[model samples]
Target: MSPKNLNVVAVAYDRLSFFEFGIAVEVFGLPRPDINPWYRFATCTAESGPVGTLAGISLQIDRGLKTLDRAGTIIIPGWRNIDERPPERLLRALRRAHDRGARVMSLCSGAFVLAAAGLLDGRAATTHWRYAERLQRDYPDTQVDPKVLYIDGGSILTAAGSAAGIDLCLHLVRRDFGAEIANQVARRLVVPPHRDGGQAQFIDRPVTKCEDTRLTSLLQWLQAHLTAEHSVESMAERTSMSSRTFARRFREQTGTTPAKWLTFER
Candidate 1:
C-alpha cells in the first residue's frame, strides 16, 4: 500500500459509542511491528472541549477535523445519534477526503453521517438492523441492505454493528496486506480472520435455549467441515429432524438457506 494510504483517521464525538470507537483503535491504531508497514491511526473530533461518552467518560481530543485532510482512510464510529446531523464542516472534510481517493467507512449508525454527506447516495450500504429502516426512509437514494454484516462498496464501506466493524476492519487488513498477514492480525486480536461481508447480520427468529445450543453446535460443525459436501437431508438427519422441519429451523436460526450458509462458510 502507498504510504499515504496507510494514514487512517477515526472520528470521535460527544456521546461516542465506545465499543465501535475501540474497534477502530484496535484494528488500525495498535502498533504492528510484525507487519512491514501498518496503518497510522489517529483520532479527531468535530467538537471542541472534552467529548463526553455515553458511559460518562470524557475524552480529550487534541486533533481536529484538519487531521482528516491528509487521511487516506476515515472511520466514522457509531454517531452520537442517528437523528442528529453531524457538523457541516466534518461532512465537508469527509467529502474532500473521499474526493481525493480516500476510503470512508462507517460503523453502525455512523452510516447516517455518510448519508448526510451524500457519500452513500446511490451506493449499497448497511447499518445496524435496528436503524436500517430509518436509514432507508431518510436516504432514499442509498441502497440500505439490512441483511448483511457489511458492504464493501469499493471506496466506501459500512459495517452493520459494533461487532461487525471488527469484521470490516479485518477485511481492510486483508485487502491492504494479504490473507496471511490479516490472519496473523486476527490471531493477535483473537477474532475470526474472515467473515463474508454478505453473511446475515443476525438470525430472523428466536429459538428455545436448547434449540439455540443445538443450532450453534450444528453451525460450528458445518464450519469445521466446509470442504465436505453435505446435503440438507444429511444435516437434518444429524439433528434427528425431518428435512422440511430442519430446513425451516435452520433458516429461522441463520436467516439463510443451508446451501447459501455453507457456501458462505466455504
Candidate 2:
C-alpha cells in the first residue's frame, strides 16, 4: 500500500533485541530534514510497563497494542525465541494491521513471529542464517532463503540479522521516499545505500579490538579521511607504536582486521 503518512510503529517486548531495535530506531525514528515529511516513529508493547532486554536490562516502551492500528508501517524487530510463540493478541494485531493494508516487517528471528501469525505462509522470506532451517520447518508453507541479507515481499519484509536490519530499513526508505532520499539517509548513517538482498549472510567478521581512547581517536580520524591510504605499518607509525603491537591492539579494539576495517571505512 502506498501510504502518504509515513507513520512507522515498532513492536517492543520482553527480551527485546537491542541491536535490531536500534536499527529501526536509527533509520525510521531519527529525524531526517533532508527528506521532507519524514517518518513518524514510535514503539508499542503487547502489554504496558517496562520491558526487559535479553540481557535483562529494562526498557520503557511507548504505547500499547492499540497503537498498531494507527501505524502505516509496522515493524517487529527480533523475536526473542523461535521455540516460543508470540502472544496471541500481538498476532491478531499484526493480522489486523496487514488486512487494513499496513506494511509489516520483521528483523532476524522476528520472521518467526510473522510465520507463527501465518503471514509468511507461501511467501518468500529470510532471517538470520542460524535460524533459517527452523523457520522453514516451523512454517512449512513459507519459502525461507537463508543466504540473503533480507527479503522484500511487497507488504511483508524480513531481514536476516543485526546489520542486515539496517539494509532492510533503508530498502523501506527507498520504497517509501525515493532513491535520493534513501541515499541521503545512508550518507548520514555512514552506510551504503543498498546491499543486495542476496548478499551472503556470514562473512569474515574480524574480532573487535579494545576501544581505548587511542583507537577511538584513530577511528574518528579514519571516518573523516576514508580516501587516505591506511595499513598496519602506517597506522602503527602514526600511533607511535610497533607494527605488531598495533595490529594486535587494532583487532582487540575494532573487532576486525585493520584491512577489513579500512575497506569498510572507505
Candidate 3:
C-alpha cells in the first residue's frame, strides 16, 4: 500500500522563532525519501527573500503565502509577538484555506494569529497556558481552554508552546495516516508515538483566583493537610456545613466535582 500524499506548508513570518520553525520543518518539511514514498513540504513566507527568526538567524523562503493554495495542511509555527497584529495577507490566506476544507494549525502563541483571523471563535482552543487568559481577554468570541496540551476542533487545531507542537503535529500525522504509520514516523524521529491531549500543560505557576475566598481557604487547608486522610465529611466539618451542602457548593465554586478537585489538590 502507498502512503497518502500530503502537501504541508509551514508559514514563516518576520521575527519567527527558529526553534519553533525547525520543529515544523523537521516534521513536515524534511525530506523523508527513505520512509515515505509520498509527502511534500515547503517553508513559505508572506513575501520573498530573507526573514529573521527569533534566534537572530535568517532564512530564505522561495515560496510565499500563495503556496497555501496547493497545501493539504497549513501551519503557523509560532507567532512573532502575541500583542502585535498579524499581517493582513497571512490572515486572509489562512481564512480562505480553512474555508476550503484545508486543515489549519497553530503552535504555541500561534493560536493568537488564528484567533485574530476569527478561526477559533465559538470553538474550543488551547495555547501555552501562560497566554490562555490573555487569549480569552483579547478574543471575547473564542472559547479558550487552558488545561489541555492541545485541542483538535475538526478542521482547526491549536497546540501549546514548545514541545506540545510536536505532540500536535504527530497527532495530525496519526489522523491523516493511521497509528501504524504514525508510530513508524515517530520511531524514526525518536519521539513518543502518542501523548493524549488531556495531558496537563504544566504551567510553572498555578493561578489561584480570589473570587472564592472560602474555597481558597479550604484549598489551602487541604494542601497543608494532604498528609492526613481527608474526605468530604472532614471538609464539610472544617467549613461548618453538611457534607451534601459542602459538595454542592464546592462544585459550583470550582466548576469541578469534589473528587476531581481532590485529584488536583493531591
Candidate 4:
C-alpha cells in the first residue's frame, strides 16, 4: 500500500475484454516519471492459457489468481460472459484481498464478475447501460444504477463502460496522488482530468461544440476570487449577459450548474 510501491493486479479471463483491460494497463501499468513510483501492474487469469478476446486478440497471461493476494489494488476488466460464473477459488481470492483492504474495481460488464463474487451485494454498483438490467435482475442484493458514469463504493469501484474505465482509474490516482497529479496523468492521456462520476452519461440536446471563452474566463476568475463574494447576477454582469443566459450557458459548457462547480472548486 505504499504509494511508491503500489501493486495493482488486473484479472483476465477466457474471452478477455480488450478495451477495459487496456485501460487498466494504460492508466496503471505505464511508467510515469512525472509521478515517481507509479503502480506496478501485472495480469492474472482465473484458469490458464492464452485468454481470447472479443476483438480476436490473444493475451498471454502467466500469472494466476494468487497474484491478487499481493496486490494493494485489484482491477477486474470486462468479463467475457456475464452468465459464466467465475471460479470459486477466484471469488475467494478476491474476497480475501478485500478483507485485507485491497481496493477492487470493475469496468463495464466486469461488474458481473464482482457481483458473482458477492462483493457487490448490498452495495451501489453500475455496469454498461445494456447490462444494467441484467445485473440488477441477477443480483437482487446489489443496487444497480443505470445512469452515472461510475460508482466509487470506497474499496469497491465500478465504472459504466469503455471510457468510464479511465475515469475510475484517474479517480484512483486522484485519491492516491492528488488533483494536480491526476490532471497530469489525464493530460498524458489527452483527456479531461476530473469528470464527476455523478454526471449523467447522456444529456438531452446536443452539447455546444464551441466554448464561450467569455464565460469560461469568468469562471476562472470566480475560482481565484471565492472570498470576493460573487453571485450569478454578478457573473452575468461581468460577462455582459443576463443572469438566466449565463447560468444556462455555464451548465452547457461545464456539464454542471455553476453553484455545484463553485461548491466543489471551493
Candidate 5:
C-alpha cells in the first residue's frame, strides 16, 4: 500500500463514545516498530472547542475535518446521538474522502453518520442490535443486518458495537498486513485474532430469573466441556428441561440457538 494509504484518521466529536474511539486508537494509533510501514494514525474533529465525552471527560483535538483530505482510512466512532445529524461539513468531508478512494468505517451508532452522508445507500451494513431497527427504518436504502458483527462493503465497513469494533479493526489489519501481523497485534491486545463478520450479535433479551440461573450454569458447564460432543437433548437433560423448552429458553437468554452458540464458542 502507498504511504498515503497507510494514513488513518479517526473522527472525534462532542459527546464522544470513548470506548469506541479508544478501539480505533488501540488498533492503529499505537506504534508497531516490529512491523515495517505500519499504519499512521491521527485524530480529527468537526466541532470546535473542547470535545466532551459521555464519561464527563473532554478531548483536545488539534486536527480538524480537513485532515480527512489526507486520510486513507477514516474511522468514525459511535456517534453521540443517533437522532442528531452530523454537521454538513463533516458529511461532505466523508463523501470527498470516499470519492478519493479512502476506506471509511463506522463503529456502532456511527453508522448513522455514514448513512447521513449517503455512503451506506445500496449497501449492506450493521450497527449495535439495539439500534439496528431504527437505522433500517431511518435509512431505507441501506440493507441493515442486525445479527452480524460487521459488514465489509469494500470501501465502507460498519461494526456492530464497541467490542465488534475491535473485531473489525483486527480484520482490517489482517486485510492489510496478513494474518500473521494481525495475530501479533491481537496478542498484544489480548484479543482473538479473528471473528467472522457474519457471526450473530449477542443481542440482549429478558429471561425469567429461574431460567437465567439455569442457563448461566449450563453455559458454564458447556464452557468447561467445549470438546465434548453434545446435543440439544443432552443439554436439555443437563438443564432438566425438555428439548423444546431448552431451545426456546436458550434463544431467549442467548439470542441464538444452542447449536449456533456451541459453534461460536468452539
Candidate 6:
C-alpha cells in the first residue's frame, strides 16, 4: 500500500534498445531516496552478463530471471524480434507474475512478447503504430487500439510508441502513490506530470495555400468552422464541386477521408 514497499524489476535482453530499457530504469530502477525509503531496483535477464543494444552498446545485467521473484512490479522493456517466438520459460514466468498479482508492463514492441505469451489475447492493447496493423493481423482475438498512447488493464499495461512509455509509467506512479508523489517524480525526471493519451500525438498543421490554394482554403475554412455542423454535401457546396468529386479530391490531397480528418482537427 505504501510507495516505498514496491520492489521493481525491469526485464532486459540482448540486442535491445537501451532507450526503451532506460525508461524503466529511470522511473523505477534508480535510487530515489528523496521520494521513498523502500523503493528498490533490479534488472532481470534470461541470461546473465552484458547484453547488446541497437547502437553497438552493451548493458550489464547481473541478475537473471530469479530477479523476477522479488519484484512487486515487472516491466518488459522490449523484445528483440516480433516474428521470432518468445521462449516458453519466459512466457510461463510472465504468466506466473500476472497470477501472483505483480503488475506487468510492456513498452512499444514489447507488446509482441506479451502477445506471444498469450497474456494479451482478448484484451485491449496497443503497440507502436508502425506495427499496429501487423499486431492486429497476427492476433485476431486481441483488440488493438492504435490511437491511444497506452492502455492500463489493471494488472497488465502496454504503451504505444517509445515516448508514450513515459506517460504510462508516470500514470502508474500516480495510480500507486498519488498526484503529489507522481508530480514529484515527474519534476525530478523533468517530464510532464500528466498527459491525456487521447490527445493527438502530433498536431496537424493546416496545409499551405501555395501548393493547392483551393483545397488549402477549404481545409482552413473547415477548421475555422469545426463547431458548426458541416456535412459532405455542405462542404461540396462550399468547394463548388460534386460530393463524390470533393471526397475523392480530399483523399488525394490529404491521404485521409474528409470525415476522419475533420474529427482529428476537432
Highest lDDT scorer: 5
Better of 3 and 5 by TM-score: 5
Runs of candidate 1 exceeding 4 Å displacement: 1-4, 205-266
- Tens-digit per-residue lDDT, 1-266, candidate 1: 53447999999999999999999999899998878678999999999999898888999999999999889899999998887889999999999999989999999999999999999999999999999999999999999999999999999999998899999999988988888988998999999999999999986343223256767788778878889889999999888889999899988877778888876666
**Tens digit of per-residue lDDT, candidate 4, span 1-266:** 22643899999887887888889999999988767767889998887778888899988888998888899899998888887888888889999999988989999998988998899999999998989999999999999999999999999999997899999899999988888888998999999999999976664542334388897688778868987777889889999999999889888887877777776666
- Best-to-worst order by TM-score is 5, 1, 6, 4, 2, 3
* Backbone clashes in model 6, listed as residue pairs: none
- Please identify which of the two predictions, 2 or 3, would achieve the higher TM-score against the true structure: 2
lDDT of 3 by residue, 1-266 (tens): 43343888899988988877787887776777666554688878896579988788888888988899888788887798888989899899999988877888999999999999989989989998889999999998888989898889988999988899988988887887778877877887899999988898883433444365777798888778776777889888888889998888887777776677666667
Which candidate would rank higher by TM-score, 3 or 4? 4
TM-score per model over all chains: 0.80, 0.75, 0.74, 0.76, 0.82, 0.77
**lDDT digits (tens) for residues 160-214 of candidate 6:** 8899999999888888888888898899889999987665445565443335567
Tell me the tens digit of each residue's lDDT in model 5 across 25-113. 99999988999889999999999999999888999998999999999999999999888999999999999999999999999999999
lDDT of each: 0.90, 0.88, 0.83, 0.87, 0.92, 0.82
User: What local lDDT score does residue 114 receive in model 6, on the 0 to 100 scale?
Assistant: 87
Who wins the TM-score comparison?
A: 5
Q: Which is the winner by lDDT between candidate 2 and candidate 4?
A: 2
How many residue pairs in model 1 have overlapping backbones? 0
* Model 2 per-residue lDDT tens digits across residues 113-195: 99988899989999999999999888999999999998999999999988999999999888887788889989989999988
Candidate 6 residue 88 Cα shift, in angstroms, is 1.9
Please list the residue runs of candidate 5 whose C-alpha ends up more than 4 Å from where it truly belongs after superposition: 1-4, 203-226, 230-266
Q: Which stretches of model 3 miss by more than 4 angstroms?
A: 1-5, 203-266
